[model samples]
Target: SQQGEEDPQALSIQEGENATMNCSYKTSINNLQWYRQNSGRGLVHLILIRSNEREKHSGRLRVTLDTSKKSSSLLITASRAADTASYFCATYNTDKLIFGTGTRLQVFP
Candidate 1:
C-alpha cells in the first residue's frame, strides 16, 4: 500500500512521559506528515518530514524519516494530559495524501 501505517496502534502514558510512534509504508514518498485528532474532532497537522530530511523537530515533537527503509517515526517528548489524541501518519502521493489507520494515544494525569 502507498499509505503509511503506524505501529502499536494504541498507547497510554502518564503526563510528563514520552510517547513514540512508528510508521511503515510499502512505497516511496515525497514527504511524510504527522497529524493529531482530539476525540470527536477533526485532525490537526503536527509535523512534516521531507524525503531528504533525516530528522526534524517542532516544539515537543520530533519526526524522522528513512526513505531507504520506507519508514518513519514520531516522538512526542514530555507528553501532557492534553496530548491525549489520535495520531496519524500520512504520505503525499501524486498531489494527494493517503492517511494510515492511526494510533490512539491516551494520556493520564
Candidate 2:
C-alpha cells in the first residue's frame, strides 16, 4: 500500500530455525532499518543498513539491502519463542521514515 511493503504477511517458524522476511519499495531510500515489536508494545530498533552497504549483522539478526532493486530483507537466525513478534522494515524518505506493512513472526516452542 505504501513505498515499503513486506511479503508473507505472516510467518510461523519453529524455535532455533531461521526466519526471513522481504520488503519491496517503489522509490529510493537513504537507509533501511529493521524493528521488532512484541504484542501491545513499542517497536525496538534491531539493525540498520545504509544504501551503500549490502548487508549488516547484529547478534542473531541480519539485514540486507539492494538499492538497484529497491528491496531489502531481514533474517533472524536461531530464533526463539521470545523472538515472536512483528517485524517491520522502514526506509528513510527525505526526513520521514516510511514503514512496511510488517510481518508477524510466531516462533513456536
Candidate 3:
C-alpha cells in the first residue's frame, strides 16, 4: 500500500514525558508530513520532511525520514496533558497524498 502505517496504534504517557510514533510506507515519497488532531478538532500540521532531509525539528517535535527504508518517525518531548491527541503521518508521492491510520496518545496530568 502506498499509504503509511503507524506502529503502536495507542500510547499513554504522563505529563512531561515523551512520546514517539513510527510510520512506514510502501513506495517512494516526495515528502512526509506529521499531523495532530485534538479530540474532535481539525488536524494541525506538525512537521514536514522532504526527500532530501534526514531530520527536522519544530519546538518540542522531532521528525526523521529515511528514504532508503521508506519510513519516518515523530517524537514529542516534554509532552503535556494538552498533548493528548491522535497523531498521523501523511506521505506525498508526486501528486498523491496518503495518510496512515494514526496513533492515539493520552497524556495524563
lDDT of predicted model 3: 0.91
TM-score of each: 0.95, 0.95, 0.94
Query: Per-residue lDDT for 1-109 in model 2, tens only?
Result: 4568898899999999999999998887778888889999999999989889999989988888989988899999999999999989988778888789999999999
Tens-digit per-residue lDDT, 41-101, candidate 3? 9998889899999999999999999999989999999999999999999987677777899
- For residues 1-104, could you state the per-residue lDDT of candidate 1 as single tens digits? 54878887999999999999999987778888999999999999999898899999999999999988999999999999999999999987788899988899
lDDT for every model? Answer: 0.91, 0.90, 0.91
TM-score head-to-head 1 vs 3, winner: 1
Model 3 residue 81 distance off true place after TM-score fit, in angstroms: 0.4
Error of 2 at 88 (Å): 0.4
| Ten residues in sequence with the least summed lDDT for candidate 3 | 91-100
After superposition, the stretches of candidate 3 with alpha carbons farther than 4 Å from their true spots are: none
Root mean square deviation (Cα) for candidate 1:
1.2
lDDT at residue 90 of model 3 (Cα atoms): 95
